[model samples]
Target: MTEDASPRALITGGSRGIGRALAAAFAADGYDLVLVARNEERLEAVARELECGYGVDVTTVSADLTDPDALEEVYERATAGGAVDVLVNNAAVAVYGPVAETDLEAERDQVRLNVAAPVELTKRFLPAMLERDSGHVVTVASTAGMRPGPFLAGYHASKAYLISFSEGLTEELRGTGVDATVVCPGPVLTGIHERSGRGSRWLERRFMRSPDAVAADSYEGIRAGKAVVVPGLRFRLLPWVSRLLPRPLSRRLARLIIDRGDPLESDR
Candidate 1:
């Protein structure tokens, strides 16, 4: 495909936060969008907003990706458009407590949504991208994936799996024009914190970037076919800093920084 060709981007979790910003950014860049999320009302609202604001075609699919049955449907829904020029694997769930104290079903949902769903989606969509020899797959992993998270263990592990999977796929498609880029962003101002029963206020004070900033960086990196893009300076420094510290020290530091009290208790 040429530069002028109108690309189509499929983004998971596109109703709000980083996913919504990515969708809007892609629409502004002249890419048609297929936005997937579980909330139908919110998704439709975003679709209308993007269509009216950017003059682009916006499709919305409402499905819970945590269920295996829904995963099959989500895969089909994802590739419904003729050709997906870009795939943004951004749908994820997070649990913020000690592993033993966390609910088992919630942990399973994290694995299903964050790990299995993306892997399956890539397997389904990447073949056509490889054949076409001109497409990009961007997985929104996290800097937390660099090490074992003391509190958010399941979420961290899932992201680490996603990063590893993306890296391996990039190597596999090295010669092919199909590129895979992994984005390791630290906490951004997203609904994730609100949903995880946590808050972004502390992170906001420290190094939390806006969804718009993260989205912009992601678009450029994916377009340039960069292997990995870390959005902000502080977040970019995290993985390296974690590497330099002793394993136990690193875990302790992570716990201290990530220890957000019950998000539901906020004065909303």
Candidate 2:
């Protein structure tokens, strides 16, 4: 779709945080919106706010993306007959604590939401985009994807798969008139911490970027067809520095950054 085209954007997890910010940004840019999330009430509120603020069409689909059937329905609801022009795969789950102690089902759900859903949704929408020869796919991966994370193993792995998938898709769509951008954001001030049972105001205040800033950069980068969008300069440096350091040293550094609580004391 060209600049003049009135594109439609589908954003998963659009009820809050970066997804919600992106929805508002796109609406202001004159795009019709399909906002997806598990919370129907919040989705409706966001939809109402966007429509009222930007005077654009907005639709909300409430479905658990971890479920394959629900994900299929979400894809159909958002992109029926090739109407969608931009896809933001932002839905994710974060399960903290040790891998052995963590709930296996929760870890599996993270994979289902963060990895499988995005791939499946892309598979469903890619053909239409190829046929039309125009569209953008933005996957909200994370800097955690650049290396293995000790405390957030499952979450990191899921984002790593997204990063690799998006990178590969960018290569395949080289001449297909479709573009994919993967956003690797570092710590951001969002409800994810609370949702994952890792809420810490002090930690967030010290280390996270504002959700608004991350959303703005992501929207601009995706619209400009950039392949990999790393928002902050600090995070942009992390991947390179991690590559330079030895694996063991890099892992220790990651643990220092991502691990919360008193380091001198045991987690218990």
Q: Please give the CA lDDT of all the candidate structures.
A: 0.83, 0.84
Cα-based TM-score, every candidate: 0.92, 0.92
Q: Candidate 1 has which clashing residue pairs, if any?
A: 197-263
Question: How far off is residue 23 in model 1, in Å?
Answer: 0.6
Q: Write the per-residue lDDT of candidate 1 for residues 49-100, one digit (tens) a residue.
A: 9999999988888999887787678667666656888889999989877777
Candidate 1 C-alpha error for residue 98, in Å: 1.7
For model 2, how does the per-residue alpha-carbon lDDT over 108-141 read when each residue is reduced to its tens digit? 8999999999999898887888888988888999
In terms of lDDT, model 2 sits at 0.84
